[model samples]
Target: MNELLLTGDERDRAGARLLALLDSYERGLPKAEILPEPDRDVLASLLAAPMPERGVGVDALFDRWEDTILPNSTAVAHPRFLAYVLGPPNGIAPYAEAVAAALNQNCNFWQLSPAASVVERSVLEWLASVVGFPAQAKGILTGGGSLATLQALATALNDRVPDFHANGLQRASAPLVVYTSVEAHRSVDKAAAILGIGLDNVRHIATDSVHRMDVGALRAAIEEDRADGLRPWCVVATCGTVSTGSVDPLDDIADLCAAEDLWLHVDGAYGALFLLSEEMRGLMGGCARADSITLDPHKLLYASLEAGCLLVRDGAKLRDAHAFDSSYLTVAEDPLMTDYMDYGPQLSRNFKAFKVWSALQAFGVSAFREANVRTLGLARRLGEGIEATPGLTLLAPVTLTAVCFAVDGASDDDHTALLERLAAENVALLGPVVVAGRRGIRACVTNHRTSEADIDLVLEWLQSRLTGRR
Candidate 1:
């Protein structure tokens, strides 16, 4: 037996300590600082220290965590943490994560993790159902939305370019071009650059007045690219742009993709899961028509960090793009389970599906749907507050949970200072955004913990600040 293995007593003590720590953290979340101040000296000491030759024991390690680590960590679960598209983890996330770690199941192959593979399949099936994809749709859990989009592009490349696996992009005669709105996430550009689809080939088409990708502009751009001897390979539509939470016209985009023989990849990372609400389905159901779609459970489903999904309309295309056979890792296929290694880049994958599955099983789907509905209501409330305020101006339509507004006569510097002041004062954490060359502040009410009181509190503070400034 390994000497590092803890005895029963030691394990008990460690478990007790960890449970206590978690309990304290949970109890304090409502009152904790949204962003903690770092102790520079302690941080520097940690950076300068070398790894200890021997273990410090569980008790000492737990003490170190409470003293040095916990104080410096951001309280992302705080009710007032409204910055970015991130949300607080669901109530059962920690337990699920701990159980997953304890199992330490390698999800690459069914032989190595049979139960995990089934669980992952179940999760994917539910996600596919949520998007209204056909029974033949298939997917894999990814690191995040960015990786999902990357994998989707890779799959599209394989489908569009003949012999892509054997000759990777080097033999293509015409440059492949991708079309997306200027409001699309940067991940698309990053993926294109990484996949050797030169940046110049990406057309950042203009958006309409409401910030959605203009289908007319997209069609014209594709035609222009074809005239310029570029192969219009794919169209990436945003299902909730990061800046303004504007969802592109997916149905129109899908129609164009079909007409042009282009792959349609929807970057639905920030807003896809809103389909949980029957009301949102009308706006986002068109995602099901895309050749592929990216969804971030971490953002919408409130799963712990590092859980994203990629769904392909045609399962075979995804397998064709990524599947590879190796003699050493030969494992017979089982009808009951999926070998996730044949799906994406990683061969030693963690069991990310467990947390997502556990959260759904624990809270039920209706709970999430209600929570999302509440967030949408809160965003609308915030938008109304902004409009009612004297100096605040709504930068874009409050189409989803993200509310972007500009302070009249405030420059970029003023917004920066306002954000800093708000953070320093523990009012709320809002992110900076740029919309159509105008700088502003963005509040994304994706956190389920956020209440109407919290929204009113922040709005009242802003209104008071503006009043004092005048």
Candidate 2:
């Protein structure tokens, strides 16, 4: 086991190799492919290889990564990679991640991870302030937005369901119903199902022309369910819907949830961070009224993968949902630090906040705000361009950083072919989306590396393709 630890020379060599790899990757990102079709033969070889009793040494492993791994990976940091609401990691993320890995802190209990606990708390505090949540707001870092939503639902269960910990939904008298818009992410339904709330009990409420959840329809559904003797447990509203970037009427939904005594959770995984921009506050400030909100720092904060958060208005409720005591893990509480095991589902949690904190500390919040504002501008530009183009149709309002549009008189296959062609030619990697049964292409300006020129190039390509000139 001791041999697993590298000597000082080995550590130095590995660190130097990693730094070189990072430098080369940053320099080559401009010309890199946004999407790379992997070689199945190479992947098959990796799968078939047997584990050796002895390690192959660090040098050989680094060589393998350069040769077999780098080529097959998607260049998510590419400037023109505008498929999903995914952002490239900030400049300092790699260094922070490396440091966190070396520290190997389990951010579960305060005594075991005092400094990590404070760091995570600091990050959560800033996030809460960003969303305009009250000082009492507290949250836990999660795997991603999906997991955050799941945890939010779990917290709601503990808060609303009588004796949830004791009965665990097995002794429920009436079927519990969850309400969300049809435009909401599938994660809502998945969470409901996983939490023993049957899919049949979920009401996919109708949306308006802009794809926002119709509050009237939601209210009517809740009333109908109540009349039918079913319990309306929770409402999951989308701050930025995945399909069209439509924000559900948060204030109206919050009012309804309050009156009905139902939990209100805003899935702001894609759009919540937009609150960083002063211009976005009006559209998203209503998120503060939600009992809980899900945010993905990895999406808009430019943090590396696997950084999502769930913030609850009443912090104690979140702790009640997941805290468990064990004699073997007994530890004294500290006034300045938090035992994060009381917050969410994980017992052994990684120090995920370091990368986010490091990026913010290195670049400052103003830098991120500027980048986000720019992405919003680029999205609006794309929408305007699509509307101005002779052969294209704007499918949805350019809200947040997602611009969804379709080619006039084109079928789903036509849009698919265009996507494939553009990706093959390295013009861009746009995603496919369907709004109100209309299939179209969606370009989300979530990449900090994306520029106005890149958007222009994509539009130019589409125009050329439409005119049969390419």
Candidate 3:
């Protein structure tokens, strides 16, 4: 018998325990602390423990997970987990992940994972349709938004820089410059740095009072770069910025990129999937005009973490940038399938698509749309509540689902203390933000489980604290 293989009875017991654990966790999510204080001694013991010479068996393994692991884990699925852009997994996510692991599809080539490649393509095609991309558009799932942006910039370089494959950034007559709003994700700067575009060449254009990218400022920056003999190659727009959920002027930015002959990449990791709501289309519809866009299913679709996407309007360009000739992996092109290895940087990829696809299939699109709409409403409610509160001030407009506010006359230290207090007392887990240099609290409604009652409870607590302090 294989040493790693579990006996039939052991496998049955393990399955039962797994199901019980999942059910209990889901049921207990509402009561669980959003951020529990971890026991350092227990963690240290885990680190210090040695591997056993003999097998621990299924029951012992489950005991370890229940007694140590579960107690220490963060309750990201809790309704009050409104700190960052992270979202809880959909109900189907765990089961989908388990099945995906068992299948163990390589997902690189058609022969190795025919069904998985098709499933991934179906998911991508559906996403492209939601963004209103043309049939020629193509994309690949990434580890997250950062990697997707990096891949997009790399594709832009290959497409714009002549003979880039043969001579990458070496012996160039002038440095290539990229443009993005100051509110854009740091991933843009990171991508530029990694691609040898250099951070110095990336211009963070100013934003307007509402935090949207200042188009005039961006245009002037491009003109200045061109006059300086630098190559202005691309513009990274933000559909939903990190701090304020502010969407840059995508239509204006797209027009500028077209006139200047620059590639347009929209980083919609935080907000693109908001398009699932038809009501959000007017605000975010300009995403289709981009040459490429980055999206995070893990953020909005509430899939398990580490699933991002980069969709390019011109499928040929993405292929031109990433595909390479390989002798051992050659296969005739089939219209029904795609060799994912030709799409992006990975030669060995897991079936990340399965979890996403499974969730969509199980819950249907309408469920996700309703969930998004609900989050938007809850955010609006919180923003209005903050505005009406005596000691609070709205730091930014409620654009999507992020509400930025501050306790009036509070210092940065005060805000930090308030955040710690909220988390410690289980009032709500909130993040601290500095909007335009004034430190504040940021409550982002990314969790589907978050409700109007949850928002009200947090607001009531904040109001009382501010009143007492005053």
Candidate 4:
């Protein structure tokens, strides 16, 4: 008998157990604690456990998962899990993930994973169409937004820097500078530093009142860098900033990039997929004009974790940046398939696109659109409630699904205490933010399970707790 393979009867039993587990979890999620209090003894026992010479039967394994693991894990899928941009996986995610694991497609090459290659390409095409990219556009699924941004910057360097593939930064006469807004994610700076661009070469431009990148400041900074004999290479714009969900001025920035001949990479990992909503198209349409953009499928698409994408307007440039020849790996190109090894850095990539495509196929696009629209409405509801309350202040506009607000005259310590109390009482799991130097709480309604009632319940609890404290 194969040591690793399960017997037919055992497989059947495991499948039934998995289905029961999923059903029970979904049914009990609402009543469960958003964050569970871990038992120290149980954790200690788990850590002290050693590898057994004999295998524990599948039945016993399932028992351990249900009795110990399930109770200790955070209920991230809970409707009131409003902490970050994270959203729970859709109903079909777990099934799709299991199928993908069983198939084990190595999506790096066309020969090894023909169907996976087609699936990924089709998914990318659909995404590009949503972003209004032309037919020539090409992209690859990534680990997440951070890696996507890093890959985009690397592509920019390969295209802009003289002899980049041959000599890299060593041949440059002066330092090359990258510009982004002060509100941009830390991934931008991290990408630059990793690419040998150095933190000193990155310019954090000022922002406007609504927390968008100040275009004037960005333009002036670019010119100033040129005047100082520094090479201005790329501009990283944000579609939705982390704190306030503010979108940078994409049209104006695209125009500036055109005039300046600089690469424009929009970090839309948090908000680009909002384009599914007809209402968001006008605000996020500028994504099409970018040379490259990053998107996180796990965020808006509600796929399982670690699903991201990087799209490049000029598909040839992306390949030019990373493609290398190897005798053992070389194969005749097929017209219908993409050799993903030429697209990005990975050569042993998994089938990350299957989960995304499966969900879209299972639920259709309209379902996601409706869910996004609902989240937007719920955010507006929460914002209005906060504004109407006597002791609360809306720190920033409800741009997307993130509602940032502060308690009137509340100290940072007080805000921290309030957040802890809310989590401990299981009212909601909100995140903390500092908007324009004021410490505040942020409730991001990204979960599809979130409802009008959930929003109202959180508001009522907050109002009661802060009734006279204001």
* TM-score for all models, in order of appearance: 0.99, 0.98, 0.99, 0.98
Q: Write out the backbone clash pairs for model 3.
A: none
Better of 2 and 3 by lDDT: 3
Candidate 3: count the clashes.
0
Q: After superposition, how far is residue 290 of candidate 2 from its true place, in Å?
A: 0.5
lDDT of 4 at 23: 98
TM-score of 4: 0.98
- For model 3, the local distance difference test gives 0.94
Stretch of 10 with least lDDT, candidate 4 = 461-470
Query: Model 1: per-residue lDDT, tens digit, 1-470?
Result: 67879889899999999999999999999889888889999999999999999989989999999999999999999998999899999989999999999999999989999999999999999999999999999999999999999999999999999998989899849999999999999999999999999899899999999999999999998888889898999999999998899999999999999999999999999999999989998999899999999999998899999999999999989999998988888788889989999999999999999999999999999999999999999999999999999889999999999999999999899999999999999889999998889999999999999999999999999998988952
354-398, model 2: which lDDT tens digit per residue? 899898899999999999999999999888989999989998898
What does candidate 4's lDDT look like per residue over 349-457, in tens digits?
A: 9999999999999999999999999999999999999999999999999999999999988999999999999999999999999999889999999999999999999
Candidate-wise lDDT, in order: 0.94, 0.92, 0.94, 0.95
Per-residue lDDT of candidate 3, residues 237-350 (tens digit) = 999999999999899898999999999999999999999988889999999999999999999999998799999999999999999999899888899999999899999999
